[model samples]
Each structure stands twice: as structure tokens, then as C-alpha cells.
Target: MNWYQTWNNPLKNLLWWLVIIGMLGSLPLAYMRHETETSTKNVEFVFDYRDLLDIADLQTNPQKFVQDQLGKMKAAGIGSMAVYESTLAEFKESRRIDLYNSRDAAALTQTFGDPSENFTYLLFTNNEAQQKLEPLIQKTFADLGVGVKPWSFKNRSGLVIQMSPDDAAIKAMDPDPIAMQMLKDQGFQLVVRLSNHREFKSNDMDRLLKQLHDLGVKRIIVDGNEVPGYTEENTEENLNKMADLLNKYGMGLAAIELLKEPQKGFSTLAKQTNYNVVRLHSFTEKDGDKLTEPLKKSELEGRIQGVADRFVLAVKDRNIRMVFINGHAVKSLDRAKVVDPLSAYYESLTGTDGAIPRIEKFGFDLGPAQPFEVHTTSWQKVARVFLLIGGLSLVVLMLSFFIPEGTLIFFVLGLIGLVGVHVLSANLYAQGLALMTAISAPSVAVMLAIRTVRSGASAKWKSGIGFGLWLLLRTSLISLIGIVYEVALLNHITYSLVLQQFRGVGLLHLLPIAIAGLYLLFFSENNTYSEKLANIRRILSSYISVLWIVIAGVGLAAVYYYLSRTGNEGQASTVEKLFRSYLENTMGVRPRTKEFLVAHPIFVLGGYLAVRYRHAVYLLFIGVVGQLSLVDTFAHLHTPLHISLLRIFYGLVIGAILGLILCAAWEIVARSWKRWAKPQLLK
Candidate 1:
């Protein structure tokens, strides 16, 4: 006789389907909002390819690693890569035991400078140190099979060796000419690093230009520690002459300046050239004691504005095509700052356009399982969708058979299905299927929530807004976990380092949630709204000792907060910056937004409700949203680090403490209200 059990109610079934539609609509809205802000700036990302270029990284399937990194760049729409140009160190070391056999260390140092001001002490004492260092050094070389032999690695660009006698010899290092050709052949622009200051001498200009032109190299990153053979006073004049020579060769010059004050030299150079890229290099110098302090937004913004004042506007006025804000992110937080609003502001000033990588347009075939294949399809094409619905429906009904009386099977089912689909959707067809799930799962949740609320046999079902929201919150948390895992795990992406392919939940990810909804609506126990709340309340209060329970929950939250961001000092600093940026984006200066007005209130209310009414799910739902946003915030791999780690601690621990306080406070109010009032709201 119950309404949920009645097979005759056609109206209730239709109502169930309507809520499902609303759920699907939220995704694309979320996706479009995060994809790109409308802008006209021609901003392109220039990533340092060191992690991919290490001698060790090269040996462990270099091609695959290249492909992986390439896929990441393509996904992020990266404009160019800064590649390391080897000097004749390998060639020099081939016949000698000394570091200086091939390298003009003093001459090179004049331009590029010692890596640090104090490196001279180490370098000058090398002869004395050699006696002590020789055995260990020789053992290392021998272990790596480098006895009196020039060492090199192969790639699409050919053989890149550690030692080459001269600039001309460097070209011969390319082994896979065809593979190396792929970089130029596929429209991948290059920004080669200039070795020492000598590479930019006026006399050597022609040779450098000819070689670069031949290799299709267009840009050069000048590491002018002090401009070799030229006084610091001639920096502007020399740069102007170099720019003119490069322009004649149809090449561009990039000047990288440290993130310091009075960038007069670089700013003067910017005012002089139109065919150029200027980078404000911000990095943590280990020796100079850089990035040791926590970053502040106001300070960072001031620095960005300083650079903007110096060159961002000038670069734009001159219509320069690219600008790089190059900073090394050795830590998670540092990486986050690298991609924050300050960086975005630079791009906004410059412009953003055509950053989507042309993966298929890449001239070389990167094998069949290429990660960049597009996966959309026309609606009329696939008739299997109807069959898929039936199949999923059947599976859900079957899966529901095993869930216990009180457990929410929908959450479990949805997580498994989405996680599996996300993991398994490797090919085109499966990708399409995954997309379908994303669109369909929201509607399914609406339907499930409505059906559960309309349980008893009646002419009209009860309004289930509260119950529906509870379902939404629960499934959303689970879905978030599954989707975050899929995107982060599949791409092997970390802190936007490897780059992520997708930034939002897709059909493949939604399939599991949809299946779980079906199980919850039709086959599960008929636990009503009152029953669910009572059970939840019991678990929070009388089910166990409240003080012990609060401590445990708070402890777990604190641990999750710490482990996720703390470990290595660099990592901790990095994560701190990352989380701070995330907070600023979500909670900063937003008085009317849902995150500020609703979820945060719900989070507090849920805590109070849990203490007073024993409803823990509501509080948990809000926390998970914050946690998930944390994932999706950095999910856009281009989002570099720039926040403090303490914000995360405040969010998790303080929120937990506040909840405990609210719970106690709510309990006191409920008791007073019951004692004084005729009609009670607490019960």
C-alpha cells in the first residue's frame, strides 16, 4: 500500500526524471566557468623541459616520457618549451679527468656567473679537492659506464651528448634526425638555452644564426649573469645590437631577468625591441636563500605590478607575441603560486589566444594510442545509448541486491562505476560512453532522491527538497573522490607539473553514480527522512561518547590536512602557497557567493545539527566540497602554486573545532527552547 511500492503512479516517475535533468546541467556550467576567462591576450606557456631531459629520465623510456610530457603540454596548450643546449662538457670529459678539460669555466662564469657567488671557493679548490674527490667520482663514472668515453643520449632531436667540441659538433649529436625533426616539423616552437655568455658575441652571431635557422630554432633564452666580455654598463647597448642581429636572422631574443627591483636594464631592452619575449624569472634560489619565506598575495601582486610597470604593458604596446613568467617550483606551494592570479594577470595584460595544442597536427606519428585524440560524436550516430541504459539499469538492480538495510548503496555503486569507467575509458568508443554517463547521472540522483521521499502509498508525495539535497551532497562527495582520483592518477599529474588532460567530470565518471541511484531508488530499504535523520543523530550523540567521537573526527581531519601538504620543506612551502591561492579564489572577497553564504553556513550548521540533532553527513558534505575544489583548483595544470599552507590547517581544524562548539551551543539552546516553549522545533 506504500507510495514507493505502488506501480500505478505515473506522475511520481515523471517527477523523479526532472531532478535528474538539473543534475546533468550543473557539470558543463562548472566546466565552462573554469576553462578560460574571456581574454584577448596572446599568452603562451613556456615550460622548462629539465624533468623530461635528465640523463636518467632519458634512459627510462625517453620516447614515452616525451610523449607523456608532450601530451600534457598539448592538453595545456603550451606555446613553447625551453630546452637545455649542451656545451662541450661531455667532449672535454671524454679524454680527461678534469671538469675544466672542455669547459672555459672562467670565461663562461664571466657571462653566466658562478651558479652562486660562493661557487668560486669550490671551483678554485677543485685541484686540492680532486685528490679526495677522484675515487668517488671515478667510481660513479665507472658505475655509469663513462670511462674516458663521451656520454650521450638519443631522442627525436637526435643524439644529445654531454661533450661536443664546438657549436658545429653539437648539431651532429642528433641521432634520430627524423624524430628530432618532429619538434620543428610539428610546429612545436623552441626556446634554446644559451650556454655561457660567449654564445651571444657579435662575431659568433652569424654562425649561431645559421645553425639556429637550419634547426628551425626561433627563440633564445639569454642567461646573461653579467653579459660576457661586455661591461654591465653596455648591457642595454649590447642587447640592442644582439636583438638587431637576431631580427635579421628571423629569430627572436628572450631576456630573462631576476624578480628584483629596478629592472632598468631589461625594461630598457623591452622598450627597444618588438620581436622578443621577456621573462620575469621568479624562483627559489637554494643558495641565495630564496623562497625560504612564505609568500603573500599583496607582496606578490606588487612584484607582478612592478614587472608590469616595467615591461608587461610595454611588451603589449610593442605587440610582442610571447612573455614568460618563469619560476622553478621545487615545492608544491611554489608551483601553485606560479599559476595564481598574479601570473594570470600578466597573461590578461598580454592576452590569451590559440593555446589549445594541435595534437593531431603534430607532424610526427606518436603511435596509435596517442593521448590527444578527440572523443566527441554526433547524436544521431549511436543507437547503442538506449541499450547502454538498459544494461546499466539491469546491473544496478543486480548490484542493489547485496547492499545492507541501513547502508546507502547508491554512494558505493556510483563511486565504483565512475572510477571504473574513468579508468577504463582509454579508447574513443569508451570515451563517448563515459561522456554519456556524466550527462545522465545528475538526473538519476534527482529521481532517486524524489522516489525515496515519496515512499508511502498516497495520492501525492511529500516535498523532498531536504532529502534530495542530502542525496546530492552524499553522491557529490563520492563522485568527487572518484573523478579526482581518475584525473590525477591517469595522467600521473602532480601540482600541474605533468599537466592534466581533462578538468571536469565526464560521462565515464558519472556512470557509476547513475547506477548507484537506480539501486537506491528501487531496490533499497525504505528508510524515510525522519528515520535517516534519527539514525544519523544517534550515531553523532547517544550512539557513543560525544567527546571521544569529536576528538577522533578532528584528529583525522588534521592528519589529512598535514599529510596532504607537509613533508619536505619545499613541498610544504609549495602546498602552502597552493592552498592559499585556492582559498583566495574561493573565499576571498566573495560576500554573496554560495561558498561564502550557503556551504560554509551548512558546514557550521551541520556541525551544530550533528551535535544537537546528530546529523554528521551535512557537515561532511561541505568539507568534501572544499577538499574537491582544492583538487580541481590545481587540476588545470597551468594553475601554478602561490598560497600559504596554514589556510588549509585553519579550514580543516578550525572548521572541526567550530563544529564542536556549535554542536554544544545548539544542544544548550534546544534544551532551553524545550523547557520554555509550548511548541518545540528541536524534536
Candidate 2:
């Protein structure tokens, strides 16, 4: 089953031409993506104002601390402040008003507690506070059907509500107007935060948004699990209403990255707003603790470096333009003082080797982040069809390796199936085709490498090295074609922002390796098709041994471990993390560890060894890891195209270097065994 001979059939030849044409056609889509990504050059760092206030409250002078921190943050390159929906507790902390629970109010006024009911009390701290917050408080409790009445204390205005202080504290309200004005006065941009915790009242929310619009707020980051105004049954209508308000006010949404799941109604809201969205990365309190909790200077520095690296990756690799940095206060036992992470946060952004400079070096400016301005062309439809054809043909070509006669049949069925999927859901069609290309491309590349190795055996070490390097380059190119096809087919902006994603990632990681192994087992030998089938039967029927069974168990464990470490959330050893940091710092883009360290070296060694030992063909199964990873790299649509290309390039160069070293070592070991060890054994 010579691969070249298989392509001698007209059908296979036609399929190859289709794939080539598809690759050529998809160039425009990739170009479009390049333009879109390059168009967005502004990155914004936003400090969480609520978190700041929470932290500030822990300081001796809350107001002075906030003012001082804001000045420092502005100096440290923070340009915006994110304000969350307000609560009574927050207002009390900010000193906009004085709030008192039933017991406290009773103690302060020298009155007995109410016999059966508890009521919350609020007192305006100043005339300005009274003028601004009086109507808001009255209307807020009035709408909830909770009793509200006027009160006076020391000639200052206040309100009494017929709810327990605890019950009153949790009620969501508008973001504090005073804080918005103060932040605006400080020359900070406002990123209003919203949540779906309150009852959905379209008119009320409209007024709130209109007020935020007047305050010069430009973006909103939704809190909790749902977008503001989202409702279960009337989700569409609610999102449409929210989208209309956002559009009317000229404000966009920031889609937070790495959420447990996407916020509900976000995709719909984004679509309705004509995709007015930017990717946002949030540095949570947990992340802050990693940097500030460590008392040792070296440990703290390393943690800060890790966070800084994430910021750089977010801005440059992922299309994250907005970063939300949280703050927290920690009680330090050794220092006997309350400490805040504000200084460490500043260091993360503006230290000597901080995220700000690194991101700016990568061509981003400090400004308000803008949504990607995606420009669509009429020709993209035709280009997508070509990409679809290319993917289907690639799939058919892979199938032809095992079922050579079914090339035309598989193509026809694939075409029909894709059409059906497209008619039902375009996203499904794109994701399905992308997965097919992902699997088929690597399988085909590995199979072709095997064919090339089998065609000639280079006994000389130098020839083996050259042959292996050549095969590596050729196979990588073949895998890259799959990337082109995937990029073209799933070129929707949704994927770029991760509002939608390329599905079947786990399958993409595993299938090609399995396919390559099966192909090697069945077809690597020069035997008739029936003989190959008989050999498989004989092997399956062979008697088992305990030692072999133990080896298989270990092999399965290795496979399980390999799969566990494939995705973004994969666990890595501390040593590996340090090594990765070194690589990233040295290279500016860290090539994946598995690619350079494991897959690529194995591939290079496999190519060299296949010529010397027939059994070495099994190494191609491992080699398929690198090939598939190259293709899978592009499946992460959120990663910028150029970054993925750079990563792949680095992986190849470094992997090839390491592979050559392994080949040289093998040669040394073999020579030693033949000259000394083998002769002694023969005696």
C-alpha cells in the first residue's frame, strides 16, 4: 500500500487538488483575521472600584488610603475603574450615608427595640448626600413594597425602611452616583458592572443606563452567571432590551475570559448589539493572594512574575483588550499590620519588567479597549465553501488510506452531511468540518512520514539526520494546511472572542494519535491486505502474560496522564512552570512543553530510527502528537493568529534541535554496544 500509488487513482488526485484549492481560497479569511486583530491595538487596565473600597475600609483612614491608592494606580498605568452595582452596605462603607440596624438604631436613639418588627435606618452624612440619595432610597424601597418614611437626626435627613438591616444590605441598586462622579473627576474611565440579581424592569433599567451613559461609562462587565436583564423564559426579549439600551448609550460589553461558563444571554446580547464586545481578563482575589500572601521576597517576586506573564499572554496571545485587577487587604501577623496588594498590583503592571511594557512592546497602547471591528466580504461565502470542500477532501483522503475504494463515496457522503449540518446550524457545520480537518491532517501527515521513511533506509547517521529533518518540515507543512482550512471555515468573530468555540478539542487531541497507531499496525508491513487482517487476528488470539499485562497497564496509565495534560487547564510540575517561565522570558513566546520536549523530539528520532529498525515505525504514533498539536494550536481561536504561528515555529526549531541531540546520543550508544558490549556478550 504505497501512499504515492494510492494517489495515482484519479479520485485521490482530484481530492488533493480540492484541498490545495481550499487552502488557497482560505488565505483571504486568514488575512481578514490578521487585519481585524491588528486593528485592535488598545489595551486597558481597570481596577475594581468595589474591591478597592472593600480593601480601603480595612485601612485606618479609608478616604485617604483610597485617594492615595488612586493616585498611585494612575501613575502605575491603570486607566479605568470598574464599579459594581451598589448595595446599602457599600454606600455605608463609602460614607455617602450612615446606616444603622435595628439594635444599633435603638441604642443610638435611647429607644426600646420594636416588639415584633425590625427596621433598617439610614442617615445622610451631609446635605449633598441627602439631596442625591433621598429620592433614590425612597423609590428603591417603595418599589419593593417595603415601607419607607421620613426621619430626622441632628437636623440631618434620613429614611426608615420596614426591613431588617441584613435583608436591606443585600438589595441590589444602581452604582453609587457619588463614586461615579468621584472616579470621573479623578480622570479615570468608568467600566460599569451589571448583574441579573434584581427584578427585570425595562423602564427602570433604561433610566439607570441613561444615567450611566451621561456619566461617560463606555463598557459593562456582567457579574454572576447572567447578563443584566436576562430572564429564563423571556431571555430573547430581555437581552434585546438590554442590547438596545447599550447601543443607544454607545456602551459595549466586556466578555470575561475563563469563566466557569459563559454568562447567560451574553452571546445573544452581543449579537443584538452588533458584536460590540471586547475580551476581558479578570485578576481575581485568589490571583492577588498568590502574589501578596507569600512573605519571602523571592517567592513574592516569582508569583508577581507569573501574574505578569498571564497579563502579557492575555493581551498579546488571546484577544484580551481589557484587564480587571482586583484588590484585597490581608492581616499580616508578622508585620502586625493590615497589608493591601495595591503595591504588588502596581508592580505587576508597571515594574521594570511588567505587563504594561511587555504588552506595549507587542504593539498595544494604553487606552480604552475597543471591540474588534470585523469587516466581512461577500467573497468569504465562496471561500468558506472552498474551505469546506478542502476539509471534506482531506477527510476522504484519510479514509482512502484504509478504504481506498471509498474515496468518492466518502466525499459524496461528507458533502451531503455537511450540507445537512449547515442547513441546521452553520456553527455546527464549521465546528464539524474543523474537527475533520484537525484529525485527518495529522493522520495523513504521519502516514506520509511513514511512507517516506519506508521508501528509503539511510544507514549513515548524517543521511538519517537530513532525512528526518526533511520529513519533519514536510509533515509540519501538511499539518499547517489543516490550520488554514480550520481558520477559514470557522472564521466567525464569535470564535475569536470565544463567545463560541471550536468543539471536539478532546477528540482532536486523541484521535490522530490513535489513527496513526492503527494505520502503522495494519498497513506498515509489506503484505497483502488479507495477510494484514490475518496477522491482526493472530496477534489478538495470542496468549497473554502477566509481565505484558503489567506493561499494558503502565502504558494505559501513561496515555491517561498524557490526555490529562493537553488543554489550557492542564496541571504542570513546579519545575516545569519555572522552565516555562524561563522559556517565555528568553523567547518572548513559550512553545508548548509537550511539543518541543516530548512530541517533536520523538518525531525526529522516529524518522531517523525507522530507517535503521522496522520496529521503530511505532514511534510515529508518538510523533503524531507534535503534528496534531500544530493543527490544534489554531483551534484556540482566541489566541491571535500571529502568536500561534510564532509558537509553532519555536516548537519546531527547538524540537528539531533536541531531536538531533537524541539521534546523536543514540548513535553513540549503538557504536559503544557493537564495538565492546556486543563482542563481550558473543564470547
**Which is the leading candidate under lDDT?**
2
Tens digit per residue, CA lDDT, model 2, 1-683: 56744644788889889999999988998888877777789999999998888998987899998999999999999999999888889889898888887788888888898867688998988988888777887788888899999877778888888999999988888888888999999999999889999888889989998899888888888989988888778888888888898899998999998888878889899999889899998888887876656468888887777888989988888899999998688887868888778888888888969999999888899999999989677788788788878889999989988877667678888899998999999878888888889889989999887766555543444667787788789899999889998888877889888988677888988899888888777876567889988989999999999998999999999888888788887888899888988998889889988899998898888878876775666676688989999998898998888889999999999999999999999999999999999999999
Please list all clashing residue pairs in model 2, or write none if there are none. none
Candidate 2 overall lDDT versus native: 0.86
Count of backbone clashes, every candidate in sequence: 43, 0
Number of the predicted model whose TM-score against the real structure is largest: 2
Worst 10 residues of 2 by lDDT: 453-462
Give all TM-scores, in the order shown.
0.29, 0.96
What is each predicted model's overall lDDT from 0 to 1? 0.37, 0.86
